[model samples]
Target: MTKQINLPFDDSGCGWYAALAPRPDVKRLQGRQQADYAVIGAGFAGLAAARRLAERLPEARILLVDAQRAGFGASGRNSGFVIDLPHKFALEHPDPAHKQRLLRLNRAAIGQLQGLVEKHRIDCQWSHAGKYQGAVGPRGQAYLDHFERLLGELGEPFRRAGREELKAVLGTGHYSDAIFTPGCYLMQPAALVTGLARSLPPNVELLEESPIRRLERDGQGGWILHGDEGSIATPTLLLGTSIFTQEFGYLRNRLLPVMTFASWTRPLTDAELARYGGQLDWGLTPADHAGTTVRMTRDRRLIIRNTYKHVPRYGRSTSDAMREQVRARHRGAFLARFPQLADVPFSHTWGGVYAISRNFTNFFGELDQGVYATACDNGVGAAWGTISGTLLADRAIGAGSEQLRDIEAVTGMPSRNPPEPFLGIGVRSRIQLAAWSSRSEL
Candidate 1:
């Protein structure tokens, strides 16, 4: 039976850290403000960009705005995996040079994340156990074979895991072939975003609940952005609005609105461990979303969702019913893979909206002279978000950023906008197909 997704905003859906933390209310902007640059969206991308901007331009007045509280958007309520899939695999860009640049940028982004975690003394439970992608049957195996060949051609550092080796790593016989890589990292995503937002350089002003009504361009190549309570006029703008930016002028047609959901398990105590294979470490794309990622929270709760999508999942909400169904499906997999935790009372689940482009690339460029955006991370990864932010800040400060220029050269994949209305039907059908296929043999 299809489950209903009602409470998409509930805390349980965001996994452990977000659930444990206090839900900070969104603070509405009251009147007026002025800054050198205005940044919208408090997610990882926006927050990180704001931080770097402060570092580069210590004296530049920065205004950060979000529709909700800091980390309340996708950044706070995500799987929080710090994995970076080279553009070659996830993106259809055939340019090996572009792929290499992506690899370097991602590597640098991960290093930046690590440095921030250490510098801030943030307790986000960071780890670098890497990640595994397994194919349980023929269909999945075919993709694995193709992926392995690509890996070989790319000369990426990777290994193929046979059935026995896969079993040893995952403690399961559910997979036939696997691909192992060392770029994936895991963390408490909400904590990381919230931690970063909390320690702004004391110069960046964060305004939450400040829904931008519209950004009116002035004659002087500046913008007058207004919120319900306040407004700001700035010569420059940084649009961190991932999915919602499309609501504006040029960005509307640029971003493809997409929704992805994740389900988290109730925390598992010690006795539960001894009863099963003691599932530790983390696994991603346990099923079809070989592109998405999955893993276990620090408290040993299973987070079964790299991301779930249909043909036309527009907007930024998830179904409560679907989230519960995901938990049930994960429970079944847990029983099959490690029977010990089947009975754990499933406590929490959550979902969020991630923006994507038709070509699976993100929007990161100076849309206008002063306005810029960095969004569309199809994968539940933070590397892109971090990279986007740094690039945005670099542009905002007039600093020379070669990485940004190189990426800008390759425009996002030609967008294939979903047909309105029926688009949902298409996405829904694809998701259902993948789910059914995961259950049955290849």
Candidate 2:
């Protein structure tokens, strides 16, 4: 059996969270309560699930619970790219149909999020800036060529650019070539999530800092969730807790928790901006999977994300030593790309968790009686989480739709991982090997 989850909260500040203005305080779950439906984990997916449920069943008493404040976990800590393209490795799947399904789902997710942002008038610095898949060297360039080929097969539009074009757009000569895909949006993740949580329908109750300790089926055909301060009983439950779902022993070894680190520099001064001339705000993903991800924010801050580790447990925080090591790596990557900004230092450094599967798939559906789940984002959390949550809610309510079918067909449950100790060892070894191989790109 999987061990119980002790939800981890990162004390190190997230630049995105710090950038946002203070939000009004939210209430925490106290004492026992009963609801018609309970949605665990108030990240992107849980928020979407609870909102959809509220819209579909206006009278239903829906409870949305989170271990920490809304947007304070992986949802707020991400690099804030709502991508509409398949992951670089996703194209490697032999089935072209699978790739197409992925593209459709990703686009659908982007559409859903766009609608919410517009309807609610979210002020999260949302922008349709698209993104660049940049290549650092020959190997990275080859990866870009493969991506372009895949894009062509999918009939997607992209602009191929060489060193000069990339330099003009990114203000750096680090990348040799790149493909610009115009379907991604950049935003302030923390603000977006918190806004979404606040905007949830009146039928839903938002409860933060309520970590579920255990969940079990009640004898009366309902579910009981035990948390630190209180418990909740509901006839139906939807879980969007990502890797923390292991507490239910649902996917167990199949879902792996990989932690990635990111850091953000303070806004550049006018002179610094002039020295680093380029488009004011842009985002770039690396052609190499293990390479660094860079984003120039609308507020003139530069963010860098790279490095990965396997961490199954939640409460254990990233050590100061590891933070320093990753910080050094980020510094090196930033200087390599923008030598002129070598003196600028990062204002904040933080880590986020991603639930990955060996087959690069997701787990969505009813895992048990009256218990539904949508998780395992495979490193693309923002979009995947949104769509999965919406679809899962539809499934729970017995509402059939083409999108749900597509998601089910494309993203079956992840394959089971190897047993315990060996599984951890293998995952760590793979991460180390990949990091070592991508040293130059870093």
Candidate 3:
């Protein structure tokens, strides 16, 4: 009797999703269906899990369900960095061996995704252009210094750049110093996700725009996922629902969902691009945890992602006023970096939610006899989510691998959070404090 209380929905203003061609007809679940395996999300993790299941159990029927079209949710709305190294937040891991293990997992994810992109010939603007970790002001510089030291300790290859060097390529002197790592890849997130969904194996059936409304035990050792128009009964289920996993009566207050906003400018004209004077395709992540993420797309658009809000009510949509305020903040960030393109108008703006835990560890194991979950991507959703989902499938099939063992060794339960009003107050206060401390980077 696990009822889904809040339905997840995204606004129609994601720049990445809008830039792509129109989607084909979506097939919603129509009747009571049965499958050997059922996956509850179509994002990176769910897609990977479904695909792995199909590959591992070719004779088995698999069903992949999503509340929205593939890539239209957080997957499509992300900053699009398939990160290989540990993120700024991940630096908190006290054990160097643990960090190294996570790095190997992240790189393995990149390899898997790269193979898929090549096999499917995904039209997404995939590039090995790497990434720039930039810092602003004193606090940000200190963070970058520590990050650089950690990179060296990990024996990773990176080049340090000062203000002038960064300005020559980024066309902005806003950054005081930066580190460039060549191990990351950048792409159009929505395109990559849509391609992956469409290219799933023959044994896997994908149903979009099908929101599961309720969950019931099937008397036997199975589960039933009830949707508005149909239902799915399966012996096995994997929840890659991210923050929405709470609605399924698991994780509850243990997870924290934070909404982040991003806005992308309309394609820059040839003259405008020349005036901006930066590499046509590059990505920058802020050194400070709360700073902005900026990107220049191959399609000649500029994207700035910043601002965070704690929106516990997933059923309620963000108000027009709040979105506008976020857009305004994005505009200011854009102008600060590229004042030369002052007149460039943003094509679309939207918000996406990413979940985190108090201890920064992801949930990656079974919750019940027949139910499994892999959520809380922290900040490296593209890589971490993919590896987690793939490994979860392996573990589900009772197959053992060194990779799975490493993930299990590092993955731990999230620290328990306080209840209700106290939890909300604490999370909001932390967000505000971080925002204030990293104001310069923002």
> What's the lDDT for all of these models?
0.68, 0.87, 0.90
Model 1 agreement with the true structure over 1-442: per-residue lDDT tens digits: 1111211133334554446467555556777787888898888788878888888888988888887677666787776667666743353458777777777677778999899899998777788877777777787777777777777767877887888876665656767777888887888877788778877897898887677777787778898887777888899888776766666565555555555666666666777655545357675554345333456666677666534654123332445576667666656555655565667665665666766665676667777778887767765447888887887788777677678776565436437565666656766676667666655422
Model 3: how far is 327 from its true place, Å?
0.9
Task: Give the true-structure RMSD of model 1.
Answer: 4.7
Which residue window of length 10 is worst by lDDT in model 1? 1-10
Every model's TM-score: 0.88, 0.97, 0.98
Native RMSD of candidate 3 (Å):
1.0
Weakest ten-residue segment in model 2 by summed lDDT: 1-10
- Give the per-residue lDDT of model 2 (tens digit) for 1-442: 1235557556556888888788788788899999999999998899999999999999999999998899889998899999987786776777888888888998998888889899999988889999999898888888888998889888889998899988887889888899999999999999999989988999999998888878877888898898888989999999999898877778877888888999989999998988888776799988888999999988899889998988767427467888889889888888888899988889998898878998877889998889999988988889989999998999999999988988998878788899989998999999999988887677
Q: What is the lDDT of residue 250 in candidate 2?
A: 81
Q: Model 1 has how many clashing residue pairs? A: 14
Clashes of each: 14, 0, 0
lDDT of 1: 0.68
Q: Which candidate wins on lDDT?
A: 3
Candidate 3 regions exceeding 4 Å error are 315-317
